[model samples]
Target: MSELNFIVTLFIAVLGPLLAIGYLKPILLVVLDSLCVEPLPGKIGAHFWVRSACVLAVAGALVLALSFGEFDGSLMQALRRALWLAAAGSFVSIAFITSRVWAPVQRRLNAQLNGGRG
Candidate 1:
């Protein structure tokens, strides 16, 4: 591949997943929320953690499964790459979920810490 093409491919490979995760996270949150029989009590509660864990597990499995078929490297190298991708995906997933779900709680805490300043 030409230099430009390689650069473009690299950019997409890195940013594409991040963008897709950001876009899909809200929908995932909605689906997970709908699975709950009763509305969760607080902004950050047990159900919130459960949903986050579920998302991480699903994302990790997907990363591993997808990476497994793509790598032509040795078994150890492939496993390492897959694990790294899973870790990155889990971090992104958690960051997305926390930023969305904990926004209210964070704002409240900030206001309290700032002595009710806006």
Candidate 2:
């Protein structure tokens, strides 16, 4: 592909997943809250926050390690890849958390909507 096309394609590829993941964050928060409730006792929110932080930290480290390569490309390419990795990590974690949070509610909603009268 042409350089401009490649850049646009990369941007879209990076952003699409990031946006999808971003949208899922609140759902994951709900899930984390629900799961960490009684089983987690008084520190539920803290626990979830810590877990998310840890995930981000790990992702950052991994991205840094993977991105360590030759200095051949333009600075823009490097910056784009860095941003993409950050977005990828954020979105993936959010999606994970939201999906977990959504599972129980999804089941209940499905049941109720299907005429369970719940």
Candidate 3:
């Protein structure tokens, strides 16, 4: 890739997953509250922040891995797979939270739409 293209790609790769995660964070909190789901141990405070940072770093590392092409040794290979693991966790968490959050609204809308039906 050209310099400009690589730069743009790197920026998007780093920002894209983060933007999605940031957008979902608040909604997840609300859903967790409404459902009264208990958070895991050590998931609050600094630990939570560290996990979020890991997600961002994994994304950036993945982008770097792909951009550079080819790796020598098992460590880079492991890091590349870690990117997939982190990305899966991030996106899957969002999906699960969104569904929980959406279910109530969908039920309400369906009730409203069918209100006049026999």
- The most accurate candidate by lDDT is 2
Clashes of each: 0, 3, 0
lDDT of 1 at 42: 38
**Residues forming the 10-long window of minimal summed lDDT in candidate 2:** 62-71
lDDT of 1: 0.53
- The alpha-carbon lDDT assigned to residue 52 of candidate 1 equals 56
- The lDDT for every candidate, in the order shown, is 0.53, 0.53, 0.51
The candidate maximizing TM-score is 2
Q: Comparing 1 and 2 by lDDT, which wins?
A: 2
Error of 3 at 100 (Å): 0.8
Instruction: TM-score for candidate 2, please give it.
Output: 0.49
| lDDT of model 3, residue 39 | 54
Model 1, 18-97: lDDT tens digits are 45556655655564454434556433344475555555645554654464432455555544554555556656665666
Q: What is the TM-score of each candidate against the true structure?
A: 0.47, 0.49, 0.41
Q: Per-residue CA lDDT of candidate 3, range 49-71, in tens?
A: 43454475445545554555233
Q: Model 2 segments beyond 4 Å from truth?
A: 1-31, 42-50, 53-61, 64-71, 110-118
Considering TM-score, which of the candidate structures 1 and 2 is the better prediction for this target?
2
Model 1 misplacement above 4 A: 1-38, 42-45, 60-70, 110-118
